[model samples]
Target: MSNSVKTINPATGKVIREFETISDQQLQDKIEKTHEAFLDWKQRSFDERGALIRKVGDLLVENQDRLSKLITEEMGKPINQAPGELQLCQGICHYSADNAASFLADEERDLPGGRALVSHQPIGVIFGIQPWNFPFYQVIRYTIANLMAGNTVLLKHAPNVWGCAEALEDIFREAGMPENVFNVLYIQEDQASQVTEHKRVRGVTFTGSAATGRKIAAAAGEHLKKTVLELGSNDAFLVLEDADIDKAVDACVTGRINNNGQTCVAAKRFVVVDAVYEQFRDAYLAKMKQVEFGDPSDENTQLGPIAREDLRDNLHAQVKESIEKGATCLTGGEVPDREGYFYPVTVLENVTPGMPAYDGELFGPVASLIRAKDEADAIRIANDSVYGLGGGIFSEDEKRAERLARDHFDTGMVSINGYYIAQPNLPFGGVKDSGYGREHGGFGMREFVNSKSLMIAQ
Candidate 1:
């Protein structure tokens, strides 16, 4: 395997920088150092760990602009969205710093003879395998929670965003954190299994494709180590017959085009009731076409290039195959003649279950519109996917919408009359093939730690 780390700018398809990859011995040393740090770090009081995490939050805020720019240049995210992602990173850090002590506090119970207590303890060194999309936010989501719980981190970032990975290490150092408390491994893909299987790495946290997540989970299981997998999603946007057509159309446009429609939780499937299907489709198509696509650095540009060229090609192929297989393209279907990896914001109508785009997650600026006969049909279509990550219900009647959200949508999270977005205070994860384990809120902090139940002899 090659030991070279090349940074390519996806926006322009140019080489930004190339660095020497870390050797096997260097990776082994990193594991050793992280283990050593965990020994002493876990003994520290919760307040101490919280203080360190708070410092991390402060550092993120101080260097948001620089970090955001690096992210934009590395992966072609919208410039405006880059700062927002940085703010999200800061918010997660602050959330963990402020609440981890309380979240992880020992719970004392009354026993027949004596008192029993349940404690949340750190699971030693945590291995984080983060993806390129939302690079900083994804890493911080796992790191802050685990570090606040008194565990050190070993981060194996996506190959495309190596600069951002290095910058993160610098931020931790600037915050006065111990050197070994957080380490970044510059290993090639071939070495991922070896690094994840290290004995000291007690738990694994991964956010990526289902295929890769399964492989990682299997490796972690082989070593008897716990793992948390946050895989892909084909989230649905359901519009009821009694819904406000304008509001539903607006939400669908934003949900499908945001982040160039590369988000795991982006609304890939749109299930709309027949009563309002025609109006909603027309409005949604117009809005999607009006979105300006250009350089992400331009403030007026609503959509930016896809993260990578391969992703753009894959999305284009899916769109072509869907159209060839009988799905009608309502808005876009071709690549734009632009400098970057740009593809037109696509909208497909009459999408059936067997179509290529309908069967798989459309990880681009393409929206699949599937008409439903009624509430039951809408629910049936929404729940027909292998992914059960997130979904949104649009309806005029709040009570009815809440009922559908509770009973019909087969997802981990549901939004009534709103677009799907995760907050730090709420639990986020999925069921079925979307992967297991939760992130954010109290559940996120506990995912990287061990819950020890104590019993007393009567």
Candidate 2:
């Protein structure tokens, strides 16, 4: 093992652990072993695999405290949020185990000339590159589904949360998963291309920025391996004339500030119709002002430090530049003098097209508010971006909001009168630059599987 990945305590800016990354030969060996493992694992009945998957879910719930603590310490997620992330990950296990068999079962069809069957078969080892935010859920979101489909997985998690990565791998092993069925590669980002190009690696899935996603997808495409990319998004939360201001504000605030506002699908843009823009603005500003930043380990802390100093600086730079380009800082723009990487909860108004806050993802505890002349303007403004991951529509008339969200909103996922990012039973991913392919629900289990047509009658 060569010293490479350094896990840091984001809350204290201290080194927690340094993992020795494996050599190229060792990585190749693991990929080969995972492929070998897949051969046997795929032969097991769905009931057999489902039973083991259920046990893994039970273990996750059973060890929630320790696992959640690891996430909170490694990445500065407020301790209160960590348990929910774990619970969501555990839900993925349960959902995948319960649904994979039916989702992937062979379909018997009647044809004009002969009978045919469609079978979902395992496609060897898939390589996953996950992000730092929502450490446990990010990995489990795709991994558990792939595993349930009988394809082994190799995870290349974010650098700052190495401990969470190892702990996840260990948990699966402890649950009696086959050796090398799920492995963690403590490799550098640069080394990822090699894994994609490896002959034994069947597919690759990544969750990160568009620039990085382009590179990974390119490498995987060159190898003719299937790829799933879940990149960043600047999702908009729209408040129409008839929206319930109190409820919308609460949901948008949670979407913006939760997990210290580092989520890929967090509601970054707030587009409100002119009729109630002022009312929404006042309430939203008041709530954001009340967010307290402190040690994430404290249960009462609503906001925690950004995962790293560089990330905090990047977020600040985006806010500063937006200010320079005519955006007004409504509140919480100034950087406070503090020990950890703490940035104030900022809200930028009068956000125009050219401003960074309007055109791009903030990726931190910053919100952008854009006023629209009417309902038409609100929908127009919401769709004006390169990203289309997730968005929300808040209105008292649920039917109208649902219709607009279904017909007009150009994003991959939308919530009516609320905010949501991940659900075990829903398909998760995005369109355009936000990345392609769907995960969760039944879609993820078949992402890397071989759907072959089995003809029966002569």
Candidate 3:
């Protein structure tokens, strides 16, 4: 494979930096160094690692704006959202630092033969394959938790966000972290599999498309290595007959258009009861139209360009195909002839299955509105998909809302009267093709380690 890493600006499609990619020998060296560091680092007290992670959090706050700007330049996330992402990263670091020690504390277990205990141990060097959509938070969510649990990390980040990857490495170094505690390998597409197959890489943690996740999982499985996969989602937003139209519309707008509608948990399918279908559609489209799209660096910009031109083109094609297939364009669907990778926030009513927008993950500012007859129909429509990452329900009837949110089929998370929020205290993941394995909270921290059982006789 070619040993060249080209950093492209998604907003303008310009090459910002061309980095010399790490050669196969260099990757092997990094794995060896990380493995060596893990031996000593894993033996250190949890308090030591926790203290360093806390320091890293402090560094994040000190440089939040600078880092946020870097993300905007690299991936075109709205300036407002960029700072929030930085803050989220800082919060995760702090949370991991404060709670990982207790989470990893050995637990006494009762067994038939003798007294036993379950202990968490570092699994050596972890290989993290993160995406560019959430350049900083995605990496931090995996890196902070893994490192806090006594494991070192080797990151192979997406090509578009190479600068963000290097910035993360610099943050650790600036926080006085030892070399090899966190190593960012500048990788070419062809070298990804080889890096994951390295002997020193004990496990893999990946966040990307389902196709890529399958390949990584297969590689890890072949080596008998542990892996955590966080894949894509075609989340549903079900609005019941009793739901408040005003609230439902507001929440749907935020859920669909946040990050220019590039989020995995963003509501892609809108299933509304026929009783208030028109009311909800009108309100939702009004709010979507009000969203301001401009340069990500603009503080007032609520929606920015889709991260890449290819994504924008794919989204445009999906919207066009949906319209051609009898879906009504309730609001924005056409791309303005602009310099940046910008597509208008699009809303489609009467979007049925078999259309491109209905069948696939629309990773842009596009939403589909489908009307259901009753509660049962709504539930059925929401679950009529292969991707089941998350879903949302809005209703005035509290009991009905709870039942729908809790009993939804195939979703990892469900929200009532609100959008999906991935907190450090919660277990975040998905089921079905949305991918398996959880991240965040205790589940996330433990993903990089092994739970070893020890038995002792009296």
Best candidate, TM-score: 2
What C-alpha lDDT does candidate 3 achieve relative to the native structure?
Answer: 0.86
Counted clashes in each candidate structure: 0, 0, 0
lDDT, candidate 2, 1-458, per-residue tens: 34586777877888888888888788888888888998898898888888888888788878988987898889999998888888888788888888988999999988777899999999898999999998888999988898889888999999898888888878888889889889999776667788899888999999999999998888888889999999999999999999989999999999999899999889999999999999999999999999878999999999999998898888899999999999999898877886778888999999999988999889888999999999999999999999999999999999999899999999999989888879999999999999999999999998999999988766
Model 3 residue 146 CA deviation (Å) reads 1.0
Best by lDDT: 2
lDDT of 3 by residue, 1-458 (tens): 55677776666777888788877888788889999999999898878888888888888878988998888888888888887787787788888888888899999999886899999998889899999989988899888888988889989898888999999899999988988999998877777788778788888999989999999899899998888988888788989888888888888888988877888889889999888888888888888888868877889888888888888888898899989999999878888886878888888888899997777899988989999998889999888988888889998888878877786555899888888668888888998888888888878878777899999987
Clashes of 2: 0
Ranking by TM-score: 2, 1, 3
- lDDT by residue for model 1 (413-445), tens: 988887867688889899988999998897888
Better of 2 and 3 by TM-score: 2
Ordered by lDDT, highest first, the candidates read: 2, 1, 3
TM-score of 3: 0.97
TM-score, prediction 1: 0.97
The residue pairs in collision within model 1 are none
Q: On TM-score, who's better, 1 or 3?
A: 1
Cα TM-score per model: 0.97, 0.98, 0.97
**C-alpha lDDT values of all predictions:** 0.87, 0.90, 0.86
Measured with C-alpha atoms, the lDDT of residue 91 in candidate 1 is 82
Q: Lowest-lDDT window of 10 residues in candidate 2?
A: 1-10
